[model samples]
Every structure is written in C-alpha cells, then in structure tokens.
Target chain A: MARLTTPLTDFYAVIPAGGIGSRLWPLSRADAPKFLHDLTGSGSSLLKDTWDRLAPLAGEQRVMVVTGRAHRAAVEEQLPELADLNVVLESEPRDSSAAIGLAAAILEKREPGVIIGSFAADHVIKGTRFFNMAVAEAVEAARAGFIATIGIVPTEPAIGFGYIHATEETELEGAPSALKVDSFVEKPNAHTAEEYVESGDYLWNAGMFITKAAVLLEELAKTQPELHAGVVALAEVWDDHAKRGPAVDKIWPTLKKIAIDYAVAEPAAAAGKLVVIPGEFDWDDVGDFASIAKLHSSGYKKDLAILGEGARVLSDASSGILITDTGRTIALVGVKDIVVVDTPDALLVTTTANAQKVKSVVDALRISGRDDVL
Target chain B: MARLTTPLTDFYAVIPAGGIGSRLWPLSRADAPKFLHDLTGSGSSLLKDTWDRLAPLAGEQRVMVVTGRAHRAAVEEQLPELADLNVVLESEPRDSSAAIGLAAAILEKREPGVIIGSFAADHVIKGTRFFNMAVAEAVEAARAGFIATIGIVPTEPAIGFGYIHATEETELEGAPSALKVDSFVEKPNAHTAEEYVESGDYLWNAGMFITKAAVLLEELAKTQPELHAGVVALAEVWDDHAKRGPAVDKIWPTLKKIAIDYAVAEPAAAAGKLVVIPGEFDWDDVGDFASIAKLHSSGYKKDLAILGEGARVLSDASSGILITDTGRTIALVGVKDIVVVDTPDALLVTTTANAQKVKSVVDALRISGRDDVL
Candidate 1:
C-alpha cells in the first residue's frame, strides 16, 4: 500500500469510477458503464489501459480504485491481480469529494508521506511516456507541499471540460513542477471556450491530481470542514474495514454532495495554496461518442467511415452491407454532425450539436416510466 | 365415385396448387407455397378452405387435386383422410393444361362419364351459398354437353383479373344453363377494366370450369391434338399407373408448353361450344398481401388503434403487446394503418398500401443476396 517508485516514491495512482452511466442506454446501463465496455475493440477497457501506463511508476499495489458496489464485480473481472483490499467500494453514490476523501483516508493508514495521484477510470490517454513523466513531476511538487492538479495541453476548444488559469511557474523538482493556478473556470459556451483555448496560459483541467494525503486533509479541514470531518470519521472505522463497514455505510448518505474542486481545490487556490502540473500527455476525458473519433491517428477518416467528409464516422461496416438489421451495417446518409447509434431495439439519431442533450432521452424515458428503454 | 345428384349425374371439381411460392420470401419459400400457409388465422389453409366448400357438392372422393411432385406430402398432411390412390402428383411443372390432363386421364378410367370442374387451390370465396348454387347450375349445363367455365360476378374493375364476355344465356330443364362466351380478355389496364365492369355482359374469368370429360377430350382433340395425344398416351397405361408413370413423365417434357384457356377454350368458342356459367359466389384470388386486408371488414382503422372509438371488432389494446425482443421495447406511437413485422434478421415498416410491394423488397433482397433476411 506504500507508494514507492522503482527509483523513488513518485505517485500513487487512484481511479474513481463509480457513476451509473445510464446515458449509453442499452449498451451501457446501470449494471455496466462505458468504462467496462470494450467499445474501442482494442481488447482492453479504458480502466485497464489507464492502469497499464501507471503501474511502472506507482508499483503494482500502489495503484488503488474507488468504485460503486454495482461495479465491484466488473472492476475485479478487469483487474484480477488487483487485491480485493485495495479496491474501495462505495456503499452508494455520494460524489467526487467523498470518493477522494475515502481514498485518502485508506492510503494514510498504510503510509504517512505518500502522494495520491487521482484519475477517472474512463479517461482515454495517449502517449503513456509523456503522462508518466508529468505524474512524476507532479509527485515531486506534491512532496514540496503544493496540491498539484494536471492541466492537460488543450487539443481543441472543447466546451465539455473545465479550464485552469496559470499565473507563474514555481521552481521545484523533476520536470516542470508547479504553477500558481489563477482561477478555475467551469465548462463554458463555444465562444468562451474558443477564447480560453486561444489564451496561452489556459489549460483544460484533466481532473487528475497529485497531493500529499495529509496536506489534502489539512486543506480540506480549513476549507470544507464538513467533508474533512466525514473523512476523519470514516478513517477511525477503516482500520477494521470488514467489521465496521455497515456502520460506515449508515453515515454515508448524510455526506455533502460536492466535487473535490469545489469543496477543496478551488477554495484552496483562492487562499493561495494551489499548483498546476502541466501535463505533457495527450489526453481526452472521452466525454461522449464524438470524442472517440480522436482516438485514431487518421483523424476520423481511415479508422471510421466519415460520411460527407468531416460530418460523421460510420463504424460497423462489413462486406458491402450499407444497411443491416442494426448489427454490422450502418448508413450515415444525408446526416451531418449527428450521433446516430443503431442498436437492435432503439435508434438514437441526434445531432452531435446536441450530444449533451442525449441525457434528455433517458430523462424522458424515465419520466414516462419506460425502464425497458431507459 | 358417381356424380349422381337426385336424378342426374354431371360435373366434377379439380384443384391445382403445385407452384412453390418464392415471392413471399422467408414465410413462403422454395419448398412451401401459398395454399399451404394458414394466412387467415383460423389455422386452416386456403387449400383446405377451398376443399371444405367444394366437398358437399363434389363429394369428398370426387373432389380431386393435381399438384407437383414436391407438394404431395403437404397436401396429405392438410387432408389426412385422403387415400394415396385419389391424389395425383405431377412429375414436373409444364403448365396448367398438362397438370389438368394428368388428372383427366386418371379420372376417365375410374368413371367414364365424369364431368371435371377445375378450381385453384388458393382462392377465397366469401359467398358460399351463391357459390354452391352456381356450381349446381353449371353441372346441369355440363350434362347438356356445354363446356362451362364459371364467370365470377364482378365486384370491382380490378386490373389483376382476366374478363369473359357472356353475350347470351340459355334456359333449359328448369335451370339457367349456359351463356355463349363471345370473347376472353387478358388483365387489362385500369380504364379497360372499368369499361369491362360497367359493360354488364362481362365477368372475371375465374380459371374454373365444368365439363364432361368425354366432351373436353373431343374439344381438345379438335383444338389441340398435340395436348389430346399426350392425354391419350397418359391414359393408355392409366390401368398400370405405377408402372407407366415414368414413361408418361418422359413424354410430358416433349409436349407444347401452353395453358388450357389458350389451347382449348379460346379456340373452342369459334364453334360456340365454350360457354359461361355465371358464378354467383364471392371469390378472391388472394394474389398478394393486400388481399389479406380484405378478410377483415374494414380497410382502415376499424380494427386498429382508434381514437375515441369503441366499436372495435378486434383490438390489441390493454397489454396486447407483440414484442419480439427480450433486450428492448417497441413503442407504437400515433400510428394506424401500419403493419409492424419485427423479425430477428429484418424488420418491415410499411403501410398496407405498400403491402403488395413487399414482394419488391424480397426481390431487392434476392438481388443483394441477403439470404438470411430472405
């Protein structure tokens, strides 16, 4: 459980993937989300690939996971070698702050000085060497008592992700160590997103973070006392996790529903205690179906059937079958900038312009009590 | 098997249903034809229904059928009580006349004075009472030595059926005997069909006929000697049908390919021997899917999902869900006059207007070589 690099103690990679991804409808339901799916056909899940890139520096047992009770079996199935004790299962969905707090409390018991590097289980990262190098640099900055958050080098003016403002760099250790985060910006409209990307100092907040467990707890105690108290309470019972598990679950539902950035990082940065770890890795949160288009080297043409030139990527083309009964043949005809999912039972045809609005279909189905579709 | 009814002996009924219907695609393929399908939902076939209506008049043993070699088993399955000796199976498909001649030759031996009445195996007759009365009248005309073909009383100017012109009728022996058929017409264009329907003298040439076997043979001898010679050759060894059956097949392929109407009836009317017996019965050919809509009372939303209407003859309201998928749900929203056939391999979403054109989809699938869908 002690975070130690082969050369030096660099970072402890922790994945939090507990959200029920109901937006994917039939393919990704409450029982299984997009992270567990081999949607890319690479024979590896996003979580599996994320772990493979991190294990070299974090060491095998140094990497841990915080997932939901529903996904525990799936997580174990994907990472069989991942020890059952290292994988933390949330009794119910509470939010990112509680998840991060749970991870920090668990790791603090085994080791005191270890830095926690957190990433989402469903993020698609390209260029592992660059990401590993960045995490190592962030680890060094964390030991120097700065809460380090990875700011991804922006590839597009994507309005889907939050952005960070960088003021000036601090001379620390390893690669580029730290920068004072001027402010945190929420996901903006297209025009504002374009402005942010054009600004040289702004980077997309990757949600990946590196910080000493004790330092994070200290910051949380000052800024978000309620969250800090809940984490402390769970830490007391965590020593005998098997016995006190039910008692911990009984208290979980009352915890504040908040993201880590809102409860700690943003407020900490406001009080002059935040640092930006400039991530050199090519990264994507893989936010939606359209984002999957960026995974291939050919930019949506060679790997996909991009009909009407840059408008659509038609996957599942086999034989000369332009139209099939929803399995192998799909035709993206006369449609431009739309996400058309052709499943056996349901056909979701909507503009990529309205990609975020896909959740509305699930919402409407839920309202109509159509659980069979939802 | 005597044809005597009360004091007189006269007519016969023959059915020919041998062509394997491939147009219906998956439901009706190379091995199964239209007559064998229980399309009416009564779990009784079109052939069986035709036999049921014809049985009382023709007498069970006298109601003969001529079919291709492949369909003999299906015929036996539908009519289980049929003796092996009563059924006639053709060696090959050479046209209706050859099939008829094969039956005629066999019946001529068992009974010398038999008058054969022929009908299609897969036709629908709505007015059975009128149909039975018409056949009785035709039998008297056949006894008077007139070769009688039933002219269906026209209900519509349907371009799908051929027409017959009955110029004059004869009254003899307390029955309306026959009409001199002036001319025969092929399936005409809409305008001509409308004119034929309004002309008051024309009736649909239903491809059914009643005539003395001896008179039919004499007519065949004068009109088509080649056909008559084939029949004679087939009859010469009719006593040893089992032994001579192979020799009969060898000579059959050499005979001219022709329909009975073209070979005998059209030419026989030049001598005024071909006469029309007006069938007062409701008759339907059931040529296409559109015809199935007729079995129901109304063509529109009478039995379908009707709004603010309660006089439904049948309604799939209240959990009458026709679901094909275990994984997904089907929603029928604001739609009527539609047939939703959901197959595992393919789905048909079309209106009953387009139901006849479903054959075009089968044709398209054949062209695409999507045999799984077919």
Candidate 2:
C-alpha cells in the first residue's frame, strides 16, 4: 500500500511463493521452488529480481512474502535483504487469491489509501523501467478508488498462460487510466490461444493486481463474503498478533480454500467494478524450465558445450543447465533439450516440456517409498 | 616343422598390444587401449584374458608379448604372470605381418617347431571347450605342416567382419583335419554379407592362427618369397645381436606395411598351401563399444541401467556401456538387442548395425580437433 503521492516509501508488496512449481521440478524441490533458483544465472533469483524491481515502488520493510513454513528458511536465506518479520509463513498452501486477502488483513492498521501491488514471485520481467512506471500508475489508480490489474501485451498465441479480455482506455483525471475489465479467461487450446493472440482485446492475465487495502477488503466483503468474514475475524486478532504473537494457522484452515481471483476479482470484474490497466512491460511468469531457458542467450537450439565460454548468464549445454561455480565446464553430446539438474544426491533429467510432469515423478517416487529420489 | 607329436612345454605366446585403436577413441586411448580395458570384466584385461586362456597350452614362463614400447608397462601390468623378459617391446608400430614375423624370429631360437597360436587380445571367446578343442586340432594340423587359421562359424550376415572362404575339408592325418581354404575375402557389404551367411561355406575371419614357426616360415618362403626373405634375413641373427636385435627397426620401414593375411595367407591360399580350421568356439571379437554391450543382458533395450536381469557370467550396474546418462532416469524402454554407451563427455546411441559407425564419429571428432571429447 502506498503512503506517498510521488513514489511510496510506505507502499507494500505481497508475493505468494507457496505454489509447488512442479513444472520447474528437479530444479524446484519441496525445500526450494522456482523463485529461489537463478534459472537465468543473472546474479539474481526470480524472487530477488522481482523484489529488487518492486522495492523502488514499495519499500523493503513494507514488502511481504507469503511462502510455505518449510520454504521460509530458504526464501530468507536467498533474500537476506528482507527483514525476518516481513516473511508471512503460510502453514499450508491456500492458493494466491486467499493469500492476497490475508496480507490485507495483517496490514489492516495501515491507511485506507495504502495501495498493495501483488506480484508473482516466479515471473521473468523485462523493461524494468516500464514495469515500475506501470506499478506507479496502478498505485495512482488505486488511490482513486479503482482496483487495477495490469494486462500484458501478448507477443504470441500462447495457450499455456491465462488471458484477460480488456476494454478500451478511459482517460482519468490523475493518470491516463485504462477501462474496466470485461472478463477473465482460462488457458485455451491452440485454436483459442491463436484467436486470443489475433484479437487485440485479449491481454495476458499476469496475476498482478493493484488496489488499496480498503477497496480490496470492501470488494472481498461484497463478492466473497465468506472469505471476507473469515479475514475480518482474523483481522480482529491481527493487532494482538502484530504486537505480541499468535499463529494464524487455526484461522487459515477454517477459511474456504479458493483463489482471490475466483472468489473476488472475477466476481468484481463481472459486477462492473474491476479495471484492466492496459500496460506494456515484458512480463513472463516463467512457468517451467523451458521458459527459464529463454531468459538468457545460449546455444539452446543445438548441441553444445560451455568449456570456457566464460561468464555465461545461463549455460544450458543442450538440455543440461549449469549454474557452475564460476568457469566450470558443462559438456553434453547426443542429449536433447532435457533439464539435467545435477544437485548433490538428486539428478533430474526430463524433457523441458515434461518438467511439469516432474511432480508426477516425485509423487510416484513417494508412493513407491523412494523418498531418496525426492 | 613337426618334430614331436606330443604337446611340448615352454611354448611362448606373443601379443602385439601396440595399435592405437583409433576407432575406440574415448574408451581406448593411446595410454590405455582396448586390450587394457576390462571390456570382458572377468577381473582381467582382454590381453590378460587371452593370456590366461593360452597360458596352459604355452607355459607362463614362455609367454611373450610383442607390443609397442609405450604399451609395454600396461601389457606387463595386465599379464603379471609374464616376466619382464618375455614382453618384447617394439620401438614403433609395424603392420601385423611384420609383427608376427618379428615374433617368429625371436621364438625360432628358443625351441624349433614351436607351436605358436597367435591370438588377438580383444576377442570374446565363448564355449571354451569348443575353442580349446578346435585350437588343439589346429595345433595338430599346424604340426603336420599346414598354415592353419581358425575360421569362426557365421551366426549372422554381419558385414562388419572379414570372411574366410573354405571350399572343402582336406583328408589329413590329424585331430580334426583342416579345410582347404579357397581364399580369404575382405569385409563385405550387406548383400555380400547376406550371401556369405546363406552360402554356409563362408566363415568369419577370426584373426586367430595356429602354426609352428618353421611351418609358417616355410609357407612364407613358398607363397611370399619377398616377405620370407625379409623375415629370414631378420631371423638369421636369432642368437646374435644384429638382425635379431633392432635390425628390423631399420629394415621394417623398407618392408611394405601390410596385414599378414594380405601379404602371406591370401598368397598361400591362392598357392594351394592354406588351411582353414573351422573354429567350434563361440568367438566374439568385440570390435567396438557395441560389441562390449552384447555381453550385457537387460530387460530394457533403450536407456538400460543394467541392474542385472539374469545370473549371467558378469554384471555390474555402475559399469556397462551406457547410451546416454543425461540424468533422465531411463526405464530402458523395453528394447531388445541394443548398445547404449553413456559417457559424461559423449553418448553413443546405436544398434549393432551402426556400432561400427562409432569409429566414424571418433574420426570426425579427431578431424574437428575435439581431442577433449576423445
């Protein structure tokens, strides 16, 4: 939430890092997920990079990470810049929509105009300047009673990601604001993905939202009354816990498990209250290992070896990805685009397309009592 | 040449372990060629195994290895049973014919009519009973003044190995009389290989020969007069330090670099002096990594991790040719009759047909300056 007109030193960021990230598995484990790995060895993790970009808009002290209790240690270890108190440990995964509402409840004492811009932890964002500008625009829009969602300009007909059917821009007083959203669409097949790309009205739903705590809470209260009531109850005990401490574990399970977009944002959009901010920022929720391959320049399409191809950002020798200890040789031959993740005990080699299926492998291993592989 | 009918003691065996084995690059290096590796992991080298099999026939004290100077240490290390005096180290690589002739010159002085069964170090001999019996028969034939070579029974239309053409059995007073070798054929194409298999008269040239020093020398004199003269001139100083010593070192370069079969056996076969002894042994000359893979039996044909499906001669999960170990836990994928060699630097995925082409890959690598891969 923003507390300044120009650039907020008091604005807040809520990141949901609880997803299993199965698609990026072998690399993303139970202990560490996609956010923690510098899939592109650009000296910053997806989460850390996301935080670095957001820190200018929202201050570091005000930003919060909602991750699993198991991953809290890893997340903190990766991002030592984060204050210990700022990490909101989720006892169990309750989905992203619920996570956003929970963050609002915890920071309820902040002013009504305090704008919260929720970002995905595992996204590849280009055009950082443009992104910061877009975030600033959303904060301004949020201050003016509008719940803003940034829609990505689709580059290709990608059916893998969610889509947003956005309306025309309506010039606002403070900022050149986009119009209210018409609808949200799930990932479609190739035909629909192509159709979505052709149709200029459809924008990639980037799972990013900008809204004041008060308006978000009000919308939740109106659209998702059950979730709102649960949050309100939790908020009653929020201050006591903020000052002294009591775990929020008991309240989370009782609350209906649902995404905020499903219970509130979609309903709010349908009810003619949600606004789609048409903004241009090269944003990618790097969903799998294949996407991570795209993050850097390498001989990805052909078989290659990085013997001393020094200072390679992301050395992906054919299928093998290496985050080497500086100038280590990564060699490969006859291996296709597989994700050869070489950790100490576990070695995962799966097709990049089948990275999402890695969760199935882990599940099968667990069922077969081969916990050693996991 | 046949002075005694009985099996003599103190018989010497010479193994030429000098060839670069270029086709088997990564696995067979100059420092550690095919003979050095435990391709037949019977707790011995291929050279050692050959020696072990032959030691009973030729006493251990009389077993001599004719290898390049560089490979002398490895040769001795592999066959520790052989004393330092027995391993005759060559200064340079002369062809096989010259090598055999050189060994003959050395053995002539030790014992006249010495039965030397020249065996290749890198062959897989199955059915030891059949092999030893066939060897004994060949030995008797050799004593009776026949230039004998053991020809293997053709199991398949294998275009990779050379063929021996034997028209009819010779009526001779020996253990199992020799077959009159019509001629020797070079490695054939698919059509010829198929025809050779169907004809039943053609046998795989086993590269195994059995003959006395005098018999071979006489045959060389009758068939290859020029080579016979050269070998005789080299052998004249058998007891002296002139030709018997490093005289061939100067003369060998002048002699044509030719295979023994081409220089002598083919000429002899054409001259009606050659005998083909049908090898009853199940011999597999492991030509490349693929030949090594045939020894392993696993349920999966593709990407096999040989956790040993059956109780065979030898089995090790960690060792065995891997086609590719890109960290993808291969299910072996229910394949039959395949050779999968996996190396950290390179992977060789091929059926038996293409196994020989692995040499082509090595050649290309060498040409391309990929010495590191080798």
Best by DockQ: 2
DockQ of each: 0.08, 0.13
What TM-score, over all chains together, does every model reach? Answer: 0.60, 0.73
Deviation (Å) of A336 in candidate 1? 17
lDDT of 1 at B210: 77
Candidate 1 Cα deviation (angstroms), residue A39: 6.1
lDDT of 2 by residue, A1-374 (tens): 22333447546888888776776545566677778867656677788888887776677777888888898878888778788767777777778756888787767654445778788898888887667767777766777778888888898888678898976675655557567788999998999999888878888999888888878888888767887877767666765666323437666776778887887779878887677776687777877655665554354555322211242222212343333223312233334554444443343444455545556666665676755444
Native contact fraction (fnat) of model 2: 0.01
* Number of clashes recorded per candidate: 1, 12
Instruction: Estimate, for each residue in B55-114, the C-alpha lDDT of model 1 and write its tens digit.
Output: 777767667888877888889989875667667777777777777776776677678889
Docking tier of model 1: it is incorrect
By TM-score, who's the top model here? 2
